[model samples]
Target: MKDETKYSQVWNLDKLYPDGSASTQFLDHISHIESKVFSLEEGLNFFNTPKEINHSSKVADLIDNIGCIRINLSQANSYITCLLAQNPQDQNAPTLKGKTSSISARFDAGLKKLQKILVKTDHHLWEDMLDTADLNPYKFILNEWRKKADMHLTDDEESLVSDLMVDGYHAWGQFYHSLIGSIKVNIQVDGERNELSVPQAINLRSHPNEEVRKESYYALEEIWEEKKEQFAKILNHIAGFRLQVYKKRKLENILEEPLMENRINEETLSAMWKVVSKNKQPFIKYLNRKANMYGHTKMKSYNFWAPIKNTNQKIKYEEAVNFILEHFSQFGTELENFSRQVFNNEWIEAEDRPNKSMAAFCASFPISGESRIFMTYGNRITNVLTLAHELGHAFHNHAMKSINGINRQYPMCIAETASTFSEMIILDASMEKAESGEEKLFLLDEKLKRSVMNFMNIHSRFLFEERFYEERKAGIVSSSRLNEIMHEAINEGYVGSFDNPSIHSWAWTPHYYITKSPFYNFPYTFGYIFSLCIYAKAKEKGKEFEKDYLALLRDSGSMSTEDLVMKHLGEDITSEAFWEKGIELCVRDVEEFITLTS
Candidate 1:
């Protein structure tokens, strides 16, 4: 069976290059870039005048050098990542991780010098130069960073903060990652006891045996409860430090900073959630139906993802690839051809095995014009959906490849649209071919689960973050206060459907109080709702919208969230009506699923 599966395959990096010598060559190129970029720093004041900037075309030349350096460093890191995916405990893994960070720190330091020059120099000068060259790769790159030029501290202070943050805020994030990844749990599988990590235990919840699912849930609850206090301390310290830093920067609101960085506004966020909160009943109805199907009167948190009766169907690797290829072909030629290239070129890793990375990601290489997808794919229907999801991301990168490299940078909000849109494509198509009542019910349930996360769960996170900042402005928010905010947020968001109060608070989620990305939670909701709207438009407009869709993807690097939506959808992001429409779409799905299930 393994031999018959295309996704039972692993990547061969030797096809990229033979060995350490290749990495050494790449490192040497970065070294050369490090020396050359310093000259740009020295010549910064000359960039004040367009006439004087003719000396090696200042920003353009700097961008080209930086692009080359990025490609080289990225390729080296990717080569190591591919190797590490196969054997996570590989000795080279830690070394490669450290080396990547060190190399990134050095690159960041040099880039900070360029940023200082931007802050001190006449901003109009660079923007004028960038505007002239539609082809000059730095167009989007400079525009994005230029927006933040006003927020930067003095040159010395900015540099010092950049250095301190590497060790201070960023290191704490790494610490959380290490702690969560290493924690072990005891879950009963088939009446046998075994220790597993959180990721592994969560995976067991999808197992066929009901007992296994129940055991996995209790095991996670036990482990998280035991470590709850320590996790609380980490959250407190991180959030406390972040608020202190924000205050020093003269930022009055925590939401203000994250909103600014997200290229969005508070009005838009509130509008989106208002719609989600109003339509919450449909989601609650769907949950109750799902719970009844599993023979529970009211749903327990543990049973949220339990399979519907007789709905377990295996979707083989080859079948999943073909399904994606066929549905994507409906989109257009360029997309279809790209999917084929990914499959034929062995660009996907989908084998399920022990000691592999816990999850999946599709990383695109701007220079190589290639994307590699990493996931341990099993022979399940959801696995196929996951494949389609990641490929959506890959297809997005493929679309952006022709854009100037600098403008290819996309915001996280727009980033998930294409991926979720692809999942919709697959799920929608899969429903048409579903053979039985059970299959239809299962598919509908999965769709509803997505709606829950996108609308209800993510909205709760935003609510929590909003209140956390409101309170934090007064003084340092204690761990207990943090938990209270979290509980209040979840209660308001969920509205008592989830009855278990014991499991509802501060469940060791690191996002609740991360220092670097203070409001990391809301972006998921933003990305989901925003992308769903775009996807709905695509379905309505059909082939007529392809050119505009491609244009949107291409310009994603250059435009703000508000500007992009206005240009593409004719809807103002700040308008509550626009978000209500997106929320309505999710409510419609829940209604449709109920009709089908009942």
Candidate 2:
């Protein structure tokens, strides 16, 4: 019963490909995308700077093909991604993934030409093409495309960079994928030893057994510690690639592309961090109290996810799903129904299996108007929250199902809006329904665990990446130096919370090696804090806010974070006060926890 692959519900990916990664249909799908990539590449040379977009339908046709190519490529890639995530050691999946990635690189080269033309297009003609070309729905993303043209090189140089990245920049990330997927964690529970996948090992972080939690943490640290040098090399090379590209683009700051990618400005980021820094003392206070509960002056880094004594901690899968859907129904019937349909239809892979991917996420398919969520559910309360969280992402995608292909893209910062908001709903509901002080404390601790993660833990990652990039410009950062930076960041964020922080954190964090998005740390904080503010608004407005929430999710595609806040909630995220308001919500819970403990 404990084996997740056997007892827990598994997602049916047959809708995606009947035979999974080995499906001939899947191969045919990839082939079609490859052909489309070639066709699109051939058309890239037929135009220069989008001539007469207002009069000629040629540019419009080109834009349409670009959209088609982009979506088709993504759909194929997403299918293979699903296959790999389930069993990272899948033999055929890697080859197929590489093929799709190669096709994607070629597709990106052609897309670069469109980006160049969009940059040089007349503003009036660009506006006319938005409507005349039937691309008005994508106005936000198209305008966004024009905004970043200052960073572009010549058309040929840009295309070449895209082509070269297939085997160079992205290849590093692919290598990391191969390395991490092969890792296995050995652990013993109740005199029985077992080998676990990285994700399964990670799930033990919140296990109720103290020794199991400690053993799992050390197992990960020991394994990743052995790979520190290799991980450091990957980190350095990944950073080097970005830095070289930045140098070639004539961009002065490393933060420029990350900030732009998240659709945020430095001021907004600065303001958010400022608010967190101001609020950290109380969070530290909570942490100190948590340490006292464990009879230690300082909580060890391995014990960060330690739980308190409680009667009800282990939540079964069936109970967890009912809890989430019930809580979601309180928010809106639509969210509840969507999640129910997804769960009933087997759209989530929650099997606790060996060689599974680490952590959880929802991947949406534009072609099918569906999303597949991946996770190894451990049946703890934390796992229930994860269930709610990923469904929120699926709901976000569902909310934007009617949106155009290009417009569906949003910055990752606001991408957490619905997910975090959904977590808040579940946390609040569980807190209110607690039957005893112990139950209340348990739920409160879970809520604050999220706070601890978003505030201290995520902050540490941000600091590490920021300092790592700064140091990387000078030379390749060493494994020892990487460890030092990681420790320093943790110490700075946690301050007096932990005497022994996890030093090998840089090695195990998949986000650090991810080539698609850098500085992925801050977005979690933004989403957490930003969603708190939205949670407040939802509670104040009650069920009516649900409509507004859906609207916000729908408009999330490519809207700047500040404008989204201003238009929906009328708050300026660039101001410290807005961030302060959000942080204050978490502070209230922390203060309550401290008082209850005292």
TM-score of every prediction relative to native: 0.90, 0.90
- Candidate 2 C-alpha error for residue 155, in Å: 4.7
* Candidate 1 error regions (>4 Å): 3-8, 20-56, 122-131, 134-143, 208-211, 473-476, 501-507, 513-516
The whole-model lDDT of each prediction reads: 0.71, 0.82
- In candidate 2, position 525 carries an lDDT of 92
Candidate 2 per-residue lDDT, tens place, 1-598, comes to: 5633223378888888789878998898888888887888777776777557554467657766777776777678778888889887789998997798778777776776667777888888777777753666566777777877767888777767776676788899989878887999999976789898787788787677778988988888898889888888888898998888889988888788889888889999999998888789888888888888887787767667767655556777888888888878877878889888888888899877777877588888877888999988876766777888898889998998886666677788888898889988887887898778888888898888889899899999999999999999999889999999999999988875886778888888889988888898899998888889988988887777888899888888758877888898888888999988888888999989988899
Error of 1 at 368 (Å): 1.0
- Residue pair clashes in candidate 1: 350-377
Worst 10 residues of 1 by lDDT: 47-56
**Model 1 C-alpha lDDT per residue in residues 1-598, reported as the tens digit of each score:** 4737553356544456445334565455446545645554455535442334343266666666666666556655766676677677677556766766676776666565566555554555555566555324565456555556556666687677777777876777767778888899887787788988777787886676777877777777777667767666566556666777676677776777778767788888778777777888888888887778777777667677777655657877788888888988876566778888888887877777788886788877665788888887777777778888898898889888886555666767778878888888888888778898778767877887888877667767778768866775676666566668877777788776765533324545556646556777777778777877877887887767767777877877777788888988898989887877777777877787778776
The TM-score measured for candidate 2 stands at 0.90
